[model samples]
Target: MPIIVNLDVLLAKRNIKSKELAKIINITEANLSILKSGKAKAIRFSTLEAICEALSCQPSDILEYVKEKE
Candidate 1:
């Protein structure tokens, strides 16, 4: 996938655990784990907003686009 999920890295840099973030964001730990593992196919705007709010970060902090070389 071109879009890489960097949630784990940001969480680590911020010294926050997955369960802590999930609790603060009101999301299930399993769902957060899926996202952290980059196995999520899509994310809701509300969920994204909650994550950003809870982590004190922006969407760009969690999501990155990598262009493939042809």
Candidate 2:
């Protein structure tokens, strides 16, 4: 997966716990964990909006694309 989820880094930078973020975003911890771990196949725009709103950041701040080494 070339797409990286920077949720954990953002959380750490903001001094927010997963539980707190999940609660704010109205998502379960398990689901949040999946997103953070880059195991989620997709994410909803509304969910992304909520995350950005809560974290005071943008989609680019949470997601990054890296080229895979061949």
Instruction: State which candidate has the highest lDDT.
Output: 2
lDDT of 1 at 18: 96
TM-score of each: 0.95, 0.97
lDDT of model 2, residue 7: 93
* Clashing pairs in model 1, backbone N/Cα/C closer than 3 A: none
lDDT of 1 by residue, 1-70 (tens): 8899999999999999998999998989999999999999999999999999988989999999999878
Over 4 Å off, model 1? none
What is the lDDT for 32 in model 2? Answer: 97
| Predicted candidate 2 versus true structure: per-residue lDDT over 1-70, tens digit per residue | 8999999999999999999999999999999999999999999999999999999999999999999999
Reference-based lDDT, each prediction: 0.94, 0.98
Residue 51 lDDT in model 1? 91
**Against the correct fold, how does model 2 do in TM-score?**
0.97
Report the C-alpha displacement of residue 28, candidate 1, in angstroms: 0.9
Q: Per-prediction RMSD in angstroms? A: 0.7, 0.5
In candidate 2, stretches whose alpha carbon ends up further than 4 angstroms from where it belongs are none
Local lDDT at 42 for model 1: 99
